[model samples]
Target: MRITADRTRCVGSGLCAERLPDVFDQDDDALVLLCADEVPAGLRQDVEEAVQRCPTEALSLDADAPEH
Candidate 1:
């Protein structure tokens, strides 16, 4: 799956980063930062959870997208 984060929509909740450090992180300003553009096969579930748990709806996952 492909993971996208809208930095502008981020509220710096750190939920995504805290739950999936491998795929998400916080910048110096604490806004959401994507550690990877594509989600690994094994981490799809975790990425989906992060997207849903994002307080500001800044995270998105495209399961139909082709892998890089």
Candidate 2:
């Protein structure tokens, strides 16, 4: 899975960073960065949790994931 965040929609809640530190990093501007070029199997659960935990719905994953 490929993770994404809508920078414009983010509210700096930091839930994504709390839930998925490996996949998401918070910048000084308070927007989270998506670190994964390709989803790693071990990080999938945390990635999903981060997406779900995003209060503004800013976090997302590509719906059409490439075959792993």
TM-score per prediction, in order, is: 0.89, 0.81
Model 2 regions lying over 4 Å from their true place: 65-68
**Per-residue CA lDDT of candidate 2, range 1-68, in tens?**
67778989998888887776777788998887777756578877767777887898997878597677
How badly does each model clash, as a count of residue pairs? 0, 0
Those runs of model 1 whose alpha carbons end farther than 4 Å from true positions after fitting are 66-68
On lDDT, the candidate that comes out on top is: 1
lDDT of 1 at 68: 50
Worst 10 residues of 1 by lDDT: 59-68
What digit string (tens of lDDT, one per residue) describes model 1 on residues 1-68? 77899999999999889998988989999998888999876998888888998888899988789755
